[model samples]
Every structure is written in structure tokens, then in C-alpha cells.
Target chain A: MTAYKGYLIDLDGTVYRGKEIIPEAVEFVSSLKEQNLPYLFVTNNSSETPESVAQKLQNMGIPCETKHVFTSSMATASYLTEQREKQSAYVIGEDGIQKALEQAGITYEEDQPGFVVMGIDRSITYEKLAKAALAVRNGARFIATNKDVSLPSERGLLPGNGSFVSVISLSTGVEPTVIGKPESIIVEQALERINLSKEEVLMVGDNYDTDILAGINGGIDTLMVHTGVTTAEQLKEKQEQPTHVVSSLKEWKI
Target chain B: MTAYKGYLIDLDGTVYRGKEIIPEAVEFVSSLKEQNLPYLFVTNNSSETPESVAQKLQNMGIPCETKHVFTSSMATASYLTEQREKQSAYVIGEDGIQKALEQAGITYEEDQPGFVVMGIDRSITYEKLAKAALAVRNGARFIATNKDVSLPSERGLLPGNGSFVSVISLSTGVEPTVIGKPESIIVEQALERINLSKEEVLMVGDNYDTDILAGINGGIDTLMVHTGVTTAEQLKEKQEQPTHVVSSLKEWKI
Candidate 1:
């Protein structure tokens, strides 16, 4: 097997499910650290800052720092800076995205903006959506953190950021440029942050649709773990197979 | 022109635009009242009660009573009753839909509902959308008041009921049964309320896509007026034209 110099790992289903952490996954991450390998925890959750995410990992006894976390909000901020146009944006999100944009020095403008950036906002209101629709109709570039339709919670699957983003897109007749997994935008950004070429890094996650497809889309190898969303039986139905498969992350050799 | 026994008219674009009433449309309605022709204002608006809509029309001197108005909310209530199943729903809407459902004796059940009814809700929140998404995913029959993507407002086109409804639909991956113009469901209910056959009624309005298309879809004759949405040039582009065309409602002979 070809050795991967660095790793890009997924959260939620891979490391933990809801508030419960997977023991094997934690051990796997620890082993990577012991081997002196570089890794980053890439996530589609745009509601929390990297500092908060790192705190959550630390609480679970996982070795993580703020620099070890890469959120979709950070990716969205990176995407905006790359455009090099007007730096003003009409943002609809929570702490994570808001802080990320602020850190990137993007000014907030409600009436007219260069970009309309949306993420999962549990405090979403019709007025916010109305403003977004009006701005998009007036020809602002639309961007979304991620396109996960349903967010899994203890209560069940709730509406995700993609669902809220649909209000503006469907009303204004415009599609947003998504910046999370299943699209290569976030992956490329993560690659640059880790300072590694695609071939040298391996993407590891439990979900085939988002994580594995993201790796495939970004031209990187993927290790699909069965501890999360996709089962081995369901994996066989897919046309494209992941580079490696394991029942748990502990089975994968560094 | 064929002498129509009954008239099905639209409100927003036909009777008024925003807060101001159309002078010609008022005269046209007065003429219909003089001839003792049965007429009803069929609207896709699901925010206001029929009484409120009638009050609005009466204020404009259009000779209207509560019985003269038919809203998509009322049509939704009727649709639910017609199903004759569990008479309960998880509603995500304003006063119109809420009252209509109450009048129909449909109980509200958030936990486990028989239906998930949606309408234009300016007070929309993520919790409401989240609840609706969870309900729909858990096997509730989803229904929408209208599929009008954009609502023409003083500020510009705002997100309409369809846009809000898209959140639940997109998240749950379930298409709703729409009871509004451009869909024949609301028109069918309006036909029954007006006590007229499709052959005996003429649908009159300004918007070609909603008002005229509803007429065509309901198998009734349509009178396209150019006072509001669709202009003469735009109407000419459509393959299926309205049965009659006029610059204003005043031009049509009662």
C-alpha cells in the first residue's frame, strides 16, 4: 500500500455521532499523531468556529488544536477572498461563518452586496430570506457553505443549510456555488492549508456520498469506514468504489 | 365574446397592485354585479382570511362580500376534508390557513400529523421549518397553498410561499400537492364554491402564468388583461393563449 504523508478526516459520523465519540476513531487519530503524520479535521458544519470544534475534540480526549480544524465556513471565506472582487457580503449564518468572514475582513452589507453567503442558521427568519431574495434578484453572487439537505440530530433529521438556501435560489431563479464536501472547493482549500499535493494525502470518512465523493472529485484517494452512514452492502451498489474500505478506522494502517 | 355565466377573478394583479386599486377593474366588477353574474375572487394568497380579502375589495368599492372571496388557504382546507382520512395536520402558515383549517374542524397535531400544510409565513423560523421537515420525513402528506416563487412587493420581489415550502420539500425530498393558481386544484375548489361548471365560468386576471394558466389548466376560458403582470408582447410568446385579450377589464362587455 502507498503511504499517505498527510490525512484529511471527517467529523460527525467518522469521529462521533451526535454527542457520543467513537473509541476506535479516537485511537486511530492518536495513532496518526504518534506516527508524526499531519492531519486536519475537515467538517461541513458551518455553525461553529474552529476553536469551538477543537474544544469539542479535546473534550472527547482526541488530540486536536484550532489549526487542526477546517470548517466549511473557513472554506467559504477562502473562496470569497479568491474572487478578489468587492469584499462586501450579505451573510446568513451562525457564529462559525460569521467569525470566519469577519476574520477574512469581509464587510457586511444588507441592501446591496457583492456576495450572498448562506449557512445553517437555526435562527433563520423570513425577513433574512426576503433580503437575500431581493439582493440576489439585484444580481449578487450567491454562495452556500454546504448542501447537506437534512441535518441529523437527536430529534431526527432537520432542515439543513441547503434547504434554507433553496428559498433564495428558487425565488430568484439562481443557483449558489456550494463550498463544502461533494464539491472540490473545500478539498482544494484544505490541500493548500496542509501544504500537500492531492496524491500525498488520503481522505478518510464514513460517508460515501460526501466524503468519498469529495476525495474522488478532488483527485485524492479515500478510505471509507463503515462506522458511519454507508454500510458495506450499500457501498457495493455504487459505481465508483473508495480506494480502501474498513469496518473501523483502527483497521487502517498508517 | 361568449356570455359567461360566472367569473373567477384574481386579486393582486387584477383588482389591485400593492396598496392601490385598479379603477378599470372596479368598474368591470360593478358591471358584473349589475348583470347579477355570479363572480368570485380566486386568489393564490394564503396569508389573509377571506373576510379580510373581502374587506380589502369592499374598501376599493368593488362590491364584495366574504362569500365573494376564495383563497388558496380555503382550498387547502377543503382538500384536507375531501381526503376524509385523519383530520389533523402540522401547519406552517399564517392566520388565513390556521383559521381555514380550524373552520374545517381539522385539529393541529405537531408530533404525529396526518398532513403538513404550508403557506406564506412572514414569521417563519428555523424551528417551524425543522418541525415541518421532520414531520414530512416521518410520512406526513405534504401540501402547499401555492407555488408562486416570488411575491411582488413594494421593496421588490420577495420570497413567496413556494420559496418557504421549498425548505421542507428539498430537505425531505418530497414534492407537495399545491393548491393554487397554475395548478388546477384550487380552481376546481373555486368552481364548486361558485356553483359553476368549467364551461360556464371565465377566469379573469392580469398575470398570464398564474391567472391565465390556472384558467387553462382548469379547462375554463381565460380573459387576459394587460393592466398588471403579463404584457401583450409577453402573452404573444405563449403557445396556449387566453381565450380573450383586453388592455383593461373595462374593455370587456358584461
Candidate 2:
């Protein structure tokens, strides 16, 4: 296997499943640290700040710092910053996205914003959605953190940020520039953050649709681990196969 | 003209615009009443009850009773009743849909509901959407009041029921049974309510997309007036034309 200089790892399915951490993934990440190879935990979750995400990883015996965590919210902020120097945004999200935008020096405006950014908001209301639709219709650039339609919960699969984002997109007939997994935007942003070329970085995740596809879309080699969503049986039917596939991270050399 | 025995009329654009009523529409309905022709006001609005709608029409000097108004909510309720004898539904909407379902004797059950009904809900929360999505994913029959993406409000075109409905439909990957105009479900239900055959009833409205398309889809003749949404120039681009077109309702001899 070609040794990569940097690793762009996925959370949830790869590092941990819900609250349970994968031991093999932890050992693999530790190996990356011992080899002095740069690695960042790239996540589509726009709800949690990097500090919080890193804290969770640390608690689970995984070596991670706030700087090692790259959320879609951070990627969105970076993308927006690159687009315009002083931009006003109409945001629909919780703490993680809001903090990211604030940290990126983006101002929040409701009436007529330069951009309309959407993330998963548990306190989502019709008024917020209306404002988003109106702003999008009024010619604001629409942006979404991720497009994961369903969120897996204890109860069942709940409506994800992508589903709520559809309200504005479908209403205003404007497609949002998605800055998360499978779209290449977030992957590109992560590569820039990690200071590595696409060839020098490897994207690792369990989900075939989001993680593997994101790597492929961003022109990066992918390592698909079968610890979460996608199974070995399901991967067989896929048209574009991942660069590398393993039953668990224990089998793969860092 | 065919001299239809009954008239199935559209609200909003056809009869009124917001709080303002069209004088020509009032005169046209008066003529219908003078001739003793049975008429029903069919609306895609799932927010207000038939009583409220009837009151609004009556206040505008348009002859209408609760029985004369047939909403998409009523159509949805009726459709559910016909689909199953004792059905349980997880609804996401306001008073109109709730009352209609209650009137139809359909019980509201959140856990593993038989059906998931979505309507225009201004007070929409993530929790409500989550439940609806979960129910739909859990094999519940998904139904939407209408597919009107946006609602024309005083501010602007706000996110309509269809937009909110997309949250569930997109999340669960389930296409809803839309019980409103342009689909023929609401029109079919309205026809049953008015006790009129397709040939004997003229669907009158100003909107070509909903009203005219509903008539065409339901195998009924349509009279398109130019008071609301679709203009004559816009209607000219349509392949399947209405049975009759008028600049004003006053120009048509009922």
C-alpha cells in the first residue's frame, strides 16, 4: 500500500458508532500519531464544535485536539470567507455552525442577506424556513453544510439537515452549494486545512455514499472500513469501487 | 359553453386575493346561485377549517356554507377513510387537517402510525418533522395536503406545506400521496361532495397549474379566468388548453 502523508478520517461510523468507540480505529489513529503523520477528523456534523468533538474523542481514549477536528461548519465558514471578505449571512443552524461563522467574522442579517447558510437546527421553525426561502428567492447564494437526508437516532431515522434544507431549495427553486461529504467541497476544504495535496492524503470512513464518494469526488484515494453503515455484500454492487476496503481498521496498516 | 349543472371553484386566485375579493367572481357565483346550480369552493389551504373558509366567503358577499367548502385536508381525510376502516395517523399540520382527520374518525398515533399526514404548518418544529419522518420510514403511508411549494404572504412567498412535506419525503425516501389540486385527488373528493359528474361540473379558476390542471386531470372541463396567477400569455404556452378562457368572470355567462 502507498503510504499517505496525511489522513482525513471520518467520525460516527469510523471512529465511533454513536457513543461507542471502535478500538481498532483508536489504535490506527494512535499509529498515525506515532508515525508523526498529520491526520484530521473530518465530520459532516455541523451541530458540534471542534472542541466538543475533540473532547468526545479524547474521552474515548483517541488522541485528538480541537485543531485535529474539521467539521463541515468550519469548511462552510472557510468557503464563505474565500467567496467574500465581508459577507452578511442568514444562518439556520445551532451552536457549531453559528460559532464557526462568528469566528470567521461573518455578520448575521435576516432581511436581505448576501448568503443563506443552512445546517441542522433542532428548533427549526416555519418563520426561519420562510426567511430562508424568501432570501433565496431574493437572490442570496444558498449554502448547506451537508446533505445527509436522514439522521439515525434511538427512536428511528429522523429528518437531517439536508431534508430541512430542501424546504428552502424546493420553495425558491434554488440549489444550495453543499459543503459536506460526497460533494468534494468539504473534502477539498479539509485538504487545504491539513496542508496536504489530494495524492498525499487518504480519506477514511465506513459509509460508502458519503465518505468514499467524497474522496472520489475530491480526487483523493479512499479507504472504506466496514464497521458501520455499508456492508461487504453491498459494496460489491457499487459501480466505482473504493481504492481500499477492509473489514476493520485492525487489518489495515497505517 | 356546456352550461354545467355544478361548479367546482378554486379559492385564492380565482375568488379572492388574500383578504380582497374579486367583484367579478362574486357576481359569477351569484349567477350560479340564481340559476340554483350546486357549487363548492375547493381550496389547497390546509391551515383553516371549512367553517372559517365559509365565513370568509360569506363575509365577502359570496354565498357559501361549511358544506360548500372542500379543502385538501378534507380530501386527505376522505382518502384515508377509504384506504382503511380504522386508521391511525401521525399528522404534521394546523387546525384544518387535524379537525378533518378527527371528523373522519381517524385516531392520532405517533408510535408506528398507519399513516403520516403533512400539511402547511407555520409552527413547524424539528421534533414534529422528526416524528413524521420516523413514522414514514417505519412503513407508514405518507400523505401530503398539497404540493404548493410556496405561499404568497404579506412578506413574500413563504415555505408552503409542500416545502415542509419535502423534509419527511426526502428523509424517508417516500413519495407522498398528494391530496390537492393538479393531482385529481382533491378534485375527485370535491366532485363527490358536490354530487356532480365530471362532464356536468365546470372547474373555474384563474391558476392554470392547479385549477385548470386539476380539471384536466380529473376529466372535467375548465374555465380559466385572468384574475390570479397564470396570465393569458402564460396560458398560451400551455399544450392542453382550458375549455374556456376569460379576461374577467363578468365576461362569462354562467
Candidate 3:
């Protein structure tokens, strides 16, 4: 077996389920930290800043720092930076994406923007969407942080970023460039941040559709854990198998 | 030529364009009024009440009353009335839909709704959409007033009711039953309202996609005028042509 040198881990399902941290995941992460292995918590959540995400993990007794968190918002900002276009955007998101763009020196413009970036926003309104639709129609480049349709909440599945993204895309008849999991863009961005080759790193997550498919699309090894969304029975239905499968993070060797 | 006993007319393009009323349309409608021919102004706009729409037309000096206007909201309410399920809905819309649902005696619900009716709303919010998505995922029957992706405004093409409807439907992986133009439901409802059979009336409009298609879908004759969304060149590209075609309403015989 090829031992992985670094790890790119998913947040919500793999490290913690909602507000509760998984005991085995904590132990595994601690073991990685003890060995001084480089690992980054790569999340599709564009609503929280890296500092907040790191703080949440620390509160759960997990070893994490702001630098160890690679979010889709950061990936999206990085993606925009490489475009070589004007660094102005009409944005729809929360603290994370807003801060990411600000950090990247991207100016916020409502009209005649170079790009229109959409992320998860709980306070979304019609006027915001109308502006986005009009901008996109006027030929502004469209982008979405992630395309997770349904957000799992205690209140059942709510509208996710992708659902909101659809409003503009459907209205303007333009598809957005998605910068999160299930696409290789975020994975490549994570690889650059971790400073590791694809062959030496392993992507670990509980969700098959986003995390595992992302690893496959990015040409990296993936370890599917059963502690979250996809069950062992459900994983069997997929054609492309993950490189490794474990009942829990404890089942994997360091 | 068959002397049509009634007429189902479309607003916006057929009768008026934005704030300006079409002169040819006014003359044609006056001829219908002078001959005492029953006519109903059918529209996909679910934002304004029939009274408001009629007032807009009456203000334009085109003989119109509340009784002569049939909106998508009214059709949606009529649809719900024919359903065997309980008459309660979690709605996402403006005055037209709200009034129609209330007039139909359908109660407003949030927690456990029997149906989820979506329409055009300029004041749309994430909270309202979240509730609609949650309700739909909880097995509520989903319905949309119209499937017009973009709404024409003085500013530009903005996100329409169908675009907003995409949010809930995309999140829940559910398709909505559309009740407006191009679906035939509104046409059937208008026929019922005007007390006319399909063979006894002609559906007149300036847009081939919505008006003409609705007539064709509802098994009625259609007259496509060249004053709106679809141009004469565009109409020639369609596989299914309208029953009658004219450059202006003045070219048609009452």
C-alpha cells in the first residue's frame, strides 16, 4: 500500500456531523498532528471564514489552525485572480467569500462588473438576484463557489448555494463556472495551498458525490469513510470506487 | 374563415408594450367591443391583481374591466380547487397570487402545507425560499405560475417567477407544475371564464413562444402578431406555426 504523505479532509460530515465532532476523526487528526503530517481541512462551506472554521474545529478539540483551513471561498478568490481580467465583481455571499475577495484585493461593483460571483447567502433578496441576472445578461463572467443543491439542516434540507446560483443562470441562460467539490478546480487549488503532488496526498471525506468524486476528478487517491452521509451499501452502487474505504478514521493506518 | 365568437388576448406585447399602448391593438379591441364579442385579456403576470392589470389597460383607453382580465394566479387557484388534496398552501408570490388563493378560500400555511404555489415576487427573500424548499422536500405538491425565465423590465431582463421557482425545485430535486402561458392550463381556465369552447375562440398574441404555443397546446386557433418578443423571422423557424399570422392587429378581421 502506498502511504499518503499529506491529507485533504472534508469538514461537515467527515470531521464533524453538524454541531457534534466524531471521536474517531478527532483521534485520527491528532495522530496526524503528532506525526507532523501536513493536512488541510478543505471545505465547500463558503459562509464561514477560515478563522471561524479553525476556531470551530479547535472548540471540538481538533488540531487545526487558520492556515490549515482551505475553503471554497478562498479557492474561488484564487480562481478569479488567475483570470487576468479586471478584479471587480458583483458578489452574493456571506463573511467568508466577502473577506476572501477583499483579501485578494477584488473590488465590489454592482454594475458593469468584470465578474459575478455567487456563494451561499442566508440573507439573499430579490433585488440582489435581479442585479446578478441583469449583470450576467450584460455578459459579466459568472462563477459559483459551490453547487451543493440541498443544505442539510436540523430544519430539513434548505436551499443551498447551487439553488440560488440557478436563479441567475436560468434567468440569463448562462451556466456558471463552479469552483467547489465534484469539480477539480477546488482540489487543484487545495493541492497548491498544501504544496504537495497529487500522487503523495489523499482526499478524505464522508460524502461520495462531492469529496470522493472531487478526488477522482482531480487525479488523487481518496479514502471514503462511513461516519457521515454515504453508507457502505450506497457506496457500492457507484461505478468508480475510492482508493481506500474505512468504517471509521480509526480503521486507517497513519 | 370561421367567425370566432370570443377572443383570448395577451397583454404586454399584444395590447401594449411597457408604458405605451399599441394603437393597432386598441382599434382591434374596440371592434371586438362594438361587435359585443366576449374577450378576456390573458396574461402570465402573477405579480399584479386582475383589477390592477385591468386598470392599467383602462388607463390606456383600451376598453377593459376586472371581469375581462384573467391572470396566471387565477388559473393556479382554479387548478388547486380541482385537486383532491387539502386546500392549504405555502405560497411564494405577490398580490395577485395572494388574492387569488384567498379568494379561492385556500388557507395560508407554513409548517405543514398541502401545496407549494410559486409566482413572481419582486420582494423575494431567502427565508421564504428556505421555507418553500423545506416544505417541498417534506412532500408538498409544487406548482409554478409561469415558466418565463426572464421578466422584461424598464431596466433590463430580470429574474422571473420561473427562475425563483428553480431555487426550490433544484434544491428538492422536484419539478413544478406550471400553470401559465405555453402550458395550456391558463388557456383552459380562460376558456372556462369567457364561457367559450376551443373552436369558438381565437387566442391572439404577439409572442409565439407563450401565446401561440398556449393556444396550440390547448387545441385552439392562434393569431400571432408582430409586435412583441418573437419576430416574423423567428416565427418562420418554428416547427409548429400559429393558425393565423399578421403584421399588426389592424390586419385582422373581427
Candidate 4:
């Protein structure tokens, strides 16, 4: 296997599953660190800040720092900055997305905004959704961090950011530009952050839909690990196969 | 013009626009009352109870009582009762839907419900949506009050009950059985309430999509008024025209 210049890793299913970290994934990241290979944890989670995410990973005994994490919020902010010079957004999300917008110098406005950015907001209210719909109808560019319809939780699969985003899109009859896994926007942005070309970077993750498909969509090689959502049998049904498939991250040669 | 035995009248646009009552519609209702024709105001609004809707109409000098009003809430409750003898629902909406479910003897359960009823909830939170989505995914029958994507408000067009309903439907990959206008369920239920057959009743409203389409879908006659959302010019684009179109309700003879 050809050695890649840099790696784009996925969180949740790839590195850890909920509260538990995959042992093989942990060892793989350690190897990357020992070899001094550049890598970034690319995640679609727009709720938690990079610091919080890094802290969780570090506590799990994984080698990670705030700079090593790149969330969908950061990608969305960077995308907005590239899309327009004057960035004012009516944002519906939690801390991570808000912080990213602030750090990117995007002002939050209620009435008339240049962009209507939607993320998974646990404190979502009708008034917030109403304001967003109105703004989008008034010709604001609609942008969503991800298009994940459901999120797996202890209780059950709950409505995700994509489901909430449908309210504005369905109501206003305007589709949003999604910027998460499987869309290629977040992967492209992550590659830019790592300062590596797509050809030189390999995207590694457990999920075939979000992680592997993201790499394929972004014109990069993908390494699929079977520790999460997609099983080996399910991968066979897919028309376009991943670049490489392994039982675990430990099986892949760096 | 045939003197209909009963009338399924619309609120918002046909009877009133916001807080102000349309004078021609007021006189039209008065004529119905004087001629001893049975009438019920059928609205897609599931937030307010029949009593509240009647109070608003009475305050505007329109002849109406609690019995003369039938909201989407009532229709949804009626549909559920007819569908299942022992119905237990996890409802997400306001006072109107809650009261209707209670009146219909449908118990509200969270953990495992037989049905997941979604309506217009202004105070909608992610927790409520999560619960509804989980319940629907767990084999609960998904039901929505209406499919009106947007509602016209003073603040402009806002996300309606249908948009919120999309969250649960989208997350669970289930299409809800809509019980409001354009679905024929509400109109059929309203016909039962008025004790009139579809041929004997004339559905009257201002919106071509909801009111007129409900009548058409229910196999009944319709009277479209030009005092609300659908202008006469806009109505021309529709392939299936309303049975009757008028500049004002006053122009039609009882």
C-alpha cells in the first residue's frame, strides 16, 4: 500500500463508539503520531467545540489536540467565508457552530441575514425555525452542516440536523447546500486545513455512508473499517466500493 | 345557484385575515344562519381549541359556537378513534390537539405509544421531536394534522405543522397519514360532524390549495373566495378549477 502524506479520520464510529474507544483505532492513531504523520479528525458533529472534542479524545487515551480536530461547524464557517465577503447568518445550532461563526467573523442577525445556517440545535424552538424559514424565503442562502436524518442515542435514533433542516427547505421551497460527510464539502475543507492535496490524503472511517462516501465524493482514497454502522455484508450491496476495506484500523498499513 | 344543505367553511383567509374579519364573509355566514343551513368552520390550525376558535369568530360578530367549529385537531382525534379502538398516542402540539385527544379518550403515553400525533407546536423542542421520532421508528403509526408547509403570519410566512411533521417522518422514513385539508380525511370527518353528505355540502375557502383542493379530493363542491392567499389570476394556473369562484362571498346567493 502506498503511504499517504496525511490522513483525515472520522469520529464517533471510526475512533470511538459513544463512550468507548476502539483499541485498534487508538493504536493506529498512536502509530501515526510516532511516525510524525499529519492527521486531522474530521467530524460532522456541529454541537461540541474542538476543545471539548479533543478533551474527550485525550481522556479516552487517544493522541489528539484542539488543532487535530476539524468539525462541520468549522468547515461551514470557512465555506461561508469563501462564498461571500460579508457574512451575516441566522444560525440555528449549539456552541460549536456558534463559536466557529464567531471565530470566522460572521455576525448573527435575526431579521435579514445573508445566510441561514442550520445545525442540530437541541434547544430548537418554533420561533427559531419560523425566523429561519422567513429569512430563507426572503432570499438568504440556505446552508446545512450535514444531512444526517437520524442520530443514534442510548434512548433510540433521534431526529438529526437534516430533519430539522427540512422544515426550512420544505417550507420555503429552497434546498440547502449541505457541507458534511458524503457531500465532499467538509472533506475538501478538511484537506485544505491539513495543507495537503486530495491525492496525498487518505480518509479513514468505519461508516460506509458518511465516511467512505465522503472520501469518494471528494476525489480521495478511502479506508473503511467495520466497527460501526455498516457491516461487511452491507458493503457488498453498494455499487461503488471503498478504496480499501479492513476488519479494523490495525489491519491497514500506514 | 344551488342552496347547499351544509357548508364546510375555512377560517384564516375565507372568514378572516389575521385579527380582522372580512365583512363580506361575516354577512355570508349570517345568511347561512338565517336560511337555517348547517355550517362548520373547518380550519387546519391545530393550536387553538374549538371553543377558542368560536370565541374569536363570535368576537368578530360572526355567528358561531363551539359546535360550529371543527379544527384539524378534532379531525385527527376522530380519525385516530376510528382507526383504533384502544388508541394511545404520543402527541406533539398545543392546547387544541391535546384537548381533542383527551376528549376523544385517547391516552397520552411516552415510552411506547400506538400512534405518534404531530401538529403545530410553537413551543416545539428537540426533546419532543426526538420522542416523536423514536416512537414512530418503534412502530407507532405516524399521523399529522395537516400538510400546509407554511403559514402566513404578521412576521411573514412561517413554518407550519407540516414542516415540523417532516422531522419525524424524515427521521423515521415514514410518511404520516395527514388528517387536514387536501387529504380528504378532515373533510370527511367534518361531513360526519355536520351530518351532511358530500353532495349536499359546499366547501368554502380562499386558498385554492387547501380549502378548494380538500373539497375536490373529498368529491364535493367548492366555493373559492378571492379575499386571501389565492388571487383570481393565480387560480387560473390550476388544472382542476374550483366549482365556483367569486370576488367576495357576498356575491354568492344562498
Best by DockQ: 2
Give the DockQ-based CAPRI class for model 4. Answer: high
DockQ for each candidate?
A: 0.88, 0.91, 0.88, 0.86
lDDT on C-alpha atoms for all candidate structures: 0.93, 0.92, 0.94, 0.93
Q: How high a TM-score does candidate 4 get?
A: 0.96
Stretches > 4 Å off in candidate 2: none
Error of 1 at B45 (Å): 0.6
Clashing pairs in 3: none
Q: Which candidate has the top score in TM-score? A: 3
Candidate with more favorable, higher DockQ: 1 or 2: 2
Clashes of 4: 0
User: Chain B TM-score in candidate 4, rounded to 2 decimals?
Assistant: 0.98
Docking class of 2: high
Q: For residues B43-129, could you state the per-residue lDDT of candidate 2 as single tens digits?
A: 999989999999999999999989899999999999999996339999989999999999999999998789999999888889898
Task: Pick the winner on TM-score between candidates 2 and 3.
Answer: 3
* Cα lDDT tens digits for candidate 1, A91-156: 999999999999999999998799999999999988999988888888889999999988998889
lDDT of 4 by residue, A1-254 (tens): 87899999998888899899899989999999999999999999999999999999999999999999999999999999998535899999999999999999999998779999999999999889988998898888999999999988998789999999999999999999999998999998998899999889999988898999999999999999899889999999999999999999888989
The clash count of every prediction, one per candidate, is 0, 0, 0, 0
Question: What DockQ does candidate 4 have relative to the true complex?
Answer: 0.86
**What's the TM-score of each model vs. the native?**
0.97, 0.98, 0.98, 0.96
Worst 10 residues of 2 chain B by lDDT: B84-93
DockQ, model 1, C-alpha based: 0.88
- The fraction of correct interface contacts reproduced by each prediction comes to 0.92, 0.95, 0.91, 0.94
lDDT score for residue A131 of model 3: 91
